[model samples]
Target: MAGIDNIMAAIPGGSTRRFYGTAHWDGARWWAKLGDGPNNLLDAWWQDPVQPLQGGKIAVDITKDEYGQAASFVIGGYTDQPRPSSGTVQEIIPAGVATQIVIMGEDAVAYTTDRFIGEYSPGDPVYLTWDAAKPTVIGKIGASAPPPTPDAPVLVPTNPPGSETLIATASDTYWAPGGWGSYSTSRNGGEDIYTGTWYGNTVTGAWFYGAQRPALQGKTISRIRFRLPARIRGAGNYNDIAIVHFYAHTSGARPGGDVARVTGPHDIPVPPGFAGGDVDLPLSFAPALVAGGGISIAGNPYTGFNSRLKDANSGRLIIDWSS
Candidate 1:
């Protein structure tokens, strides 16, 4: 028997519009009264009452037997809000009572809504556009890993007889000499002659340069050639003697573990009339050049013999190889 004013005062936000009161059982069923103020409408609801109350709008909880169903109605509440235009799938609930999904968009804002458009896993790109006045999911773009590339055979050009491709070349200078020890210069014979003396020790008389040939990496070295104006100097019969030794290193300083070696003095003596000529020695030892490594060449005179290698402007060490 609670009056309208008493019911409005008993509930939250008393005397406000749509002010509802606590529910109770009037012996037969559950009943809740609401106040609509003076000159406004009165409201009442019941779960299992047979008679209607006087002077009020009556509403009943019709879904009393349905499990997990909401029994009350709200005027300005929404079950799901509008999502953004574009986002990425953050999570998905496929087999739950409420099948829904979560997405993340700009400013890292997250939104959870029922999956209405398509099936999506996590990290799937989604685009939503307004269609017929409703936000509808239009497309899903997924990023998959690319396929691996297969190894192909390297194409090598066929050169004519006695022709070769120059992989790398290094020259010598009298001023720097470039790691060549026991170096001496003689200008007494009207021409400047450079000499790198070898004393059987591997540390002395060698020249090295950077051997990072990107084009020659992983390629088979078919042949190697050396071109240097050299001679057996001093008062000894050192004809047809091995004077220079070529090597390869993985890193740092000359003569560091010979990865490949090529000997000089191929039984052909120095040219007549000329002081020294190009000692052309073609080597047939084919070694596969390892990646990230370098090449080096050092003078290794036969035991006790002392030799001289001269570079007057146009001297070079050449490497000929196949791809």
Candidate 2:
């Protein structure tokens, strides 16, 4: 097993179930063995809506068979999906002192966690966040990076507000080459254009670029805007504009339910050369997000515009909402 299952789960039959190990292609479909166990409480079953990528870790769900031993386990989600959380504040930076944190190899800002608690003195769990990356901090936290159950992690708000902003920099990007397990990368490294099948000869398809919006229970989004930095489009994809789609994100940040996408300065028009200045992509969609429900975004890889949008945390997926 590449990684052991941290969460425990229960099956109807009786035996405890597991859902981690090296995910592999079994000729027919992809699967990872539930680590040897007597576990029952379904550990970390974040309703992932997609398949595992090669070399990526896997989460499993028992299907059809009785609850005890389960007839079969199906790949439920890619572990390491949520933006890695840096447990506890290593040190507290005042309101706007500008800070940085390294998560899963990406440099995340310390201010991203929603309304840091007044009593948060360092050692406490600072991993709570509305989304993964970006500058500003908002309100409420969704799921833990890993280990925590599907129930969204909650923090006592310092002075709770009716509004919160989920920045794009606070997002997580995962990649998979072959058909094994998926791994996460900091949004620090700009995400790629949605190419669906980024693999060439051996590997086939699987690249999810997205951010997990915080569980803003009882509130609704007031405005949703994507700030895209200057970018250059190529002839490969007919220089078409990138279109982003939103979906219900499983707890682990997996591309669940429907396919998704990502990238920086994603939808601005560019000439053959580097487009100057940042531009906001205008989207016309209902801000009908369920109060406090976890949501996600995915890139439309069919466009084949695999160019890199290499801006720092400046380019973001800004979501503003009120209760």
Candidate 3:
């Protein structure tokens, strides 16, 4: 599933809106006032807070409809954070620790940083995720943050056990030649990269040039994602498609070995108007596929061409380096 901000951005009509507030308990009812300063501190709503009020000051997000009706709420989250991007760790709690670090310009602890904030020299840049009154840091600027659990369900297995996920787009994507040869010699080269196999209705086994992305140059891939718009080849026929092969090539120019594969009629009864979602295929390379940094990928369908991944660069690959 897409994040809240991502979802909101996708919505064309702005019927619903969100507001930030500072929560409080007015004797009995849990209430929150706008964070826009004392002069404009309007009580947005009086709803149950999301988390235990560890500290007296708790940040909250109120979700309301156009008519000022708050439907839900979020606590100590990104919606109320003072800093939206990277900030310097001005002061650590125990002089060197990052449990609670203050931003360079702030008078209070900006975030309850990650345990693996990585040896910061008191004033290192770090990303953060607000989790109530305690915002969590993303780690040192150089290291990637581990989103162990996916924000929401995309395809199969709501939350892949893997800690890190990197989305990479396919580069040099095109239809493989009648004869599998060099990538440059394809019919549609140097264009938007696309992937997936096509076991044609005709006896021609013309697969995609292969799903290769430059962003995923030399990393070890542990999972791959593809959009499955279950629109079959011909309306009358029941294509018992089995395996969707996921290929990644770290050595050669084209996709070589299988990075992952899933076999099933997962979307059997293709709905009325071709409605289907994403699916995450898991990868398994024995003996720990420890390459330099990242891994590139490519793949084709088992039967008919049935992948709906085409957004200039929307292909996604997950690496087990835990990001």
Candidate 4:
């Protein structure tokens, strides 16, 4: 009992457009009849007959128009029995059953059922039967499609953390008389000699440098020490009292205007040259180290005595700080 599936007819150029019908094989030939509708009542018979042998089958593909009306049909080949409904195994469960599948007639919709009869992987073509209440997977059809290719990985860069540090050092000896803007009569000793003059109440002169000078730029003077060789003019008199004062200036030169008095106006008693030792003065309140422009040092001799700062291996200003 072989037969063609359901068929529908289309009327060209007519409002009574389409109608459903059926076709069957009557042992020796194919026969068809349209439904009893207006302009659709007709019987059709295959012009070329098909005579099936004792145990044989046939396959066919029918073409349809845009209106889903039969336009033409082709007999593909012959087989043993009617072809069973088949699908591709979309997903398989642990129980060796296909839970999701795509069928010939319902390819767009994934049909869910416990139908698979054997262990199967996804994408394996399958033969199935849905005649019973639940669908059943009767057998495998063919090999599955290949798995999709994967993409490559990407690379990125990472940076390390940052930190802070403090740099400190002792600077070289910076001289005075050379950086000083104004001065009185002074002599230069190649190594060791007494140069500046002495007067009553005014022993030595003032020496200063201008503001924003390059040597002191972006630096603070943390400690300042001066090496001075001193001696009294008369051999017998040791009462040559002199006060050495260090000052940081803002504007004008020496003894006037905005002045930051640093180091000391401390007294130093000048002994006879044979007994005179080094004068070590540690300066304080050196605000000019950060704020003002330059610094200076002057001498104040007490009333009746005359003192002088000898120049030889002395009068070197040493500064230490962190920039």
lDDT of 2 at 129: 39
TM-score result, candidate 4? 0.27
Candidate 2 minimal-lDDT segment of 10 residues: 200-209
Cand. 1 Cα-lDDT? 0.39
Error of 1 at 167 (Å): 8.9
lDDT of each: 0.39, 0.36, 0.38, 0.38
Show the lowest summed lDDT stretch of 10 residues, model 4. 165-174
TM-score of each: 0.28, 0.28, 0.28, 0.27
Residues 74-121 of candidate 1 have per-residue lDDT tens digits of: 122111335368888778776443378777754367766664565677
RMSD of each: 36.9, 22.1, 16.2, 46.6
Which stretches of candidate 4 lie above 4 Å from their native place?
1-204, 209-220, 235-264, 267-270, 274-280, 283-285, 289-314
Candidate 2: segments with Cα more than 4 A from true spot: 1-162, 169-190, 196-215, 229-235, 238-248, 251-309
Deviating ranges (above 4 Å) for candidate 3: 1-83, 96-99, 104-109, 114-116, 129-134, 139-222, 229-262, 265-278, 282-323
